[model samples]
Target: MTTASEPRTSTGVPLPPAATDQPPAPPGPAAPPQGPPAGTAAGTAPGTAPLRALLGYARPHRAVLLGTLLVVLVASASGLVQPLVAQHVLATLGSGGSVVGPIVLLGVLVVLGAGLTGLQSWWQQRTSERVVRQVRRDLVFRLIRLRVPELDSRPPGDLIARVTSDSTLLQSAATEGLVLVANGALSVVGAVVLMGVVNLELLAVTLGVMVVVGVVIMLVLPRIREAVARGQQSVGAVGAALDRTLGAARTVKANGAELRETGTAGDAIESSYQAGLLAARYVAMVKILSGVSIQAAFLSVLGVGGALVASGHLTAPALIAFLLYVFYLASPIGSLIAGAGMLQQGLGAVGRIEQVKQMAVEEDVDDASPVAVRTHSTAPAVEFDDVQFSYAGRAQALRGVTYTVGGGTQTALVGLSGAGKTTMFALLQRFYEPTAGQIRIGGVDIATLPRSEVRRRIAYVEQESPVMAGTIEDNLRYSSIGATDEDIAEALRVTRLDALIERLPDGLRTQVGTRGVQLSGGERQRLAIARALLRKPEVLLLDEATAQLDARNEQALRDAVDQAGRRCTVILIAHRLSTVTAADQIVVLEHGRVRALGTHQELVDNDELYRELAASQMLVGEDGDPVEDLAPVS
Candidate 1:
């Protein structure tokens, strides 16, 4: 529970205005980060690993994918027959030959084409939806299981983007995009084969042009992938910035910093825009080159075939057929370029998705030493021995900090902010392991027990006492899922939140609003306590639980603690001497080390820092004893 004295953001609001209204302005012209484009390696030869990974997603829907392929092939074959029919009809009309059979064949081809098109559409949508669903489920499950520390470093908006935007891209790529690529590839192959049948020499010229185009496409494709990946990263960066700004929206408006925050967001958007343009530029260039190359190849075939016809080595009908085959070649050549471009885009998305998957997940516990936690009726005891911890940085938050509290005893940790009090509780919860020493609960080393077991036995009500974005009942139920409404009422009664709930329109089911904005600080703190009480843990850890309350709320919180402590151990972290005076033991930490350990009165009389602190607060009486207002340990 927080006291009125607790620190809050200078600007108080959940999200900034720019996030909800306008996105940030575009970034200035800055080059994207240099890296190998997605699906391509820098300084390394090409490999099949990327294709194998992509194919894995398709494996589950193999039957539908196969069906799609068959439909595409049938559709392509039917389409090929049209060009043949057209040439036959044209040659017949030109030379006064029969055209009835060609027209009938063309009609049959049209009907077959329609049927295959319908089948392809169904399979494309169904298979895409299924794969997208699988990806979303996997990503969500992976995110939920990610350890707290890793999650702490990421922004929620960017993570949400992965679940939403990234998955959508994959869906498009798998469905309509995949169908086009496959069909286009088949059409190219069929056209090449038909060209060879009509005239082998002209077919050889077409192949040479295709080879050159392929080489150019290979060279251009990596650029597209690199640009696309940069674009995605820029989008994520924009999201992170917007999330931060919105999370502090009130502060920005209150402080008149909206313009500044908007500028920041705008810069991020510009970066993404620029990256998109870069990718688009390369795509345009590749399209132009392929178009010119295909036209050149067609003209070359016409020239070569004309010379052969002039030499009396080729028939007019045959030459016309060869030209028709060459015209068919244009579709595949365009498809090849488009496919390369799309392949790059998909690879870029995969790279982003893989970044999340690669993070180390929380360690799984072994089943052999199963830990079963049952809170005893008596107060829970806790012990720490030479614990040392650093918060990612080099400076230590706790060092050689040792303390103990027995069952039925009340202990308080008092120090300035960053004096290791919060770090001690973090160690007990195993949010971060100590670089040295050990912490134990009821004689069992905390690290030895499974995380779930350790946390189940300790009820923690932090200073902020985060009230999640849900209904009051939903947030309270987190402590004990099986808790009935009656049990919830009882816990709320114990923490003095029943009155607050009764006043709410929906009582227990009332929406607390995001981060409990609907509730006052004290109310939020009381709700946290109610949650803890419902769990009925053996040990209760309160970090500045009463630091944010007014006098009346503080008294209410103190009384709730007294009532609950009758059944469990209470370890409180406080900066107020009045709060600590009631503790059976007070542990004073200075610069990450325990400097004094005793009751408030004893420490005030002996320890220099403790004495100075007590006097500064004027907590001493005329007789040099702790003042009555200080509320000595009960």
Candidate 2:
């Protein structure tokens, strides 16, 4: 629906992490066993899901992960030699060893470090891409398995954000952040030990300063996790708003509500901005606190070493070497802070990701279960016995509404808008299990049948008859994936669209555009009928297929319906009596119950409602008799 003329809103937020020592606990209900769970609180504690989950994906690539880790560890340990070597050169120069040798050694170390760093980057990124691909695969598979009803209430943009933005964050954290945490921890420990080897007094001063930094970090980190989680949520909200506004861009322009939609989207963007700023503020605080602590620790070491050297208790060479090791601690310490922040952000993302994952997906029916056949030699029937349903409470959409479609017949369902014609379809699809009911497709209860098998036995043409973005040929092939080209042609021909298709340059190959926008109302309905025809289903459910068509279009649809009735059980919901006059049986519905059931002639003669509908159609003659112009029943 979006176009260049539509008012666009900004929803992007810079993805950033807070530098802290700890992350908050994971919140919300547990994710379903595959990914993160649904209903889990927004923010999650550090390590709640476990690095082990990463290993679960990594298990297949253990050799690669282990090899990559070894190389990275070697590179990190090798890089550690730089400061010590520089200190050694300083001492050698003080004792007058040739400057060329030390300078050449330093150059060698730099080249080696650069080469190792490059290798580490390549390996980590490769492993990360593989792991992310696996996660995305699992996520997509699980998403598809979720029932349609669950998706109906969710925002398309939010789902996109999870797969694209949220997943990317997790990938970065796994590869880069994990490496930093591991190497940084090693560097800190190694430096500490090296410092102890050089001078206990200096090491003690460094440890004391680190303790202060740790305490400050603990106080600041939890807030950062909360802010990061909220910021991401705000971004998702903004994306959702923008998605909605853009989806209805044509409607907005037609109504001159561009400004109003933009304002609504803008509100979402503003909330994202505020959340980003809040997270940034906390990240800045952590950065400042860590920087100040590192600086103080340096000054304290310098001061103590200066006094020791002046008092002749510490050698000039030893003090310089010890100080160099202390400086080495800085890089790892800074990395640790950065890694902590990434950890917090990753945890937040996991919590959000799990929200969808935790929802219970519909279980697959056993392949051996009995199939629900909708057609029998005796009767073409659709029946509901003791049906009961509720979405969230006792407010039932359908309650014990029972009916039947006689054999080789067409049944028209009539009622007020909410009288539950649609609810009947929902039950037929098994989208949600009934609280209690037996829906017999023919003589067999649908619940006892395998879900897929039951669905395969029936053909559903929805109200809108939605068509995808593919070509007309592709659309027809959707109902029966293994159908041949001739099968598709036959379906098109049967629906009376073959002549129309031949007029277009590309015919069946013509793109339908998104949701089949290029086609008229009649064309879309015919396309749906063509799709259903390909399946050669035993039972057909047409929901208001002709409600919105013009006269010509309605006649075309009527022809198609007539063709369908020859070989299948047809159940239709239509407001027009003309569409049902030829039907073998017409069931009148009101307030979720059948009020009348008979052939068109029989109903007109016996039922007051049927007589009123027929009389109002202007088909009745002057003498209060049925008109001679009435179309003959098929």
lDDT tens digits by residue: candidate 2, 100-132: 876787788778767887887898889889877
The ten-residue window of minimal lDDT in model 2 covers 15-24
Please identify model 2 stretches exceeding 4 Å from their true place: 1-47, 50-63, 97-107, 365-380, 605-634
At residue 602, give the lDDT of candidate 1. Answer: 85
In candidate 2, how many Å is residue 208 off? 1.4
CA lDDT scores, all candidates in order: 0.73, 0.68
Query: Compared to the true structure, candidate 2 yields what TM-score?
Result: 0.85
Q: TM-score for model 1?
A: 0.87
Q: Evaluated with lDDT, which candidate comes out highest?
A: 1
lDDT of 1 by residue, 465-574 (tens): 88998999898888777788898888887777888877888987899887888888888988888888888778889988876677777787788888777878899988
Q: Against the true structure, what is every candidate's RMSD? A: 7.3, 9.3
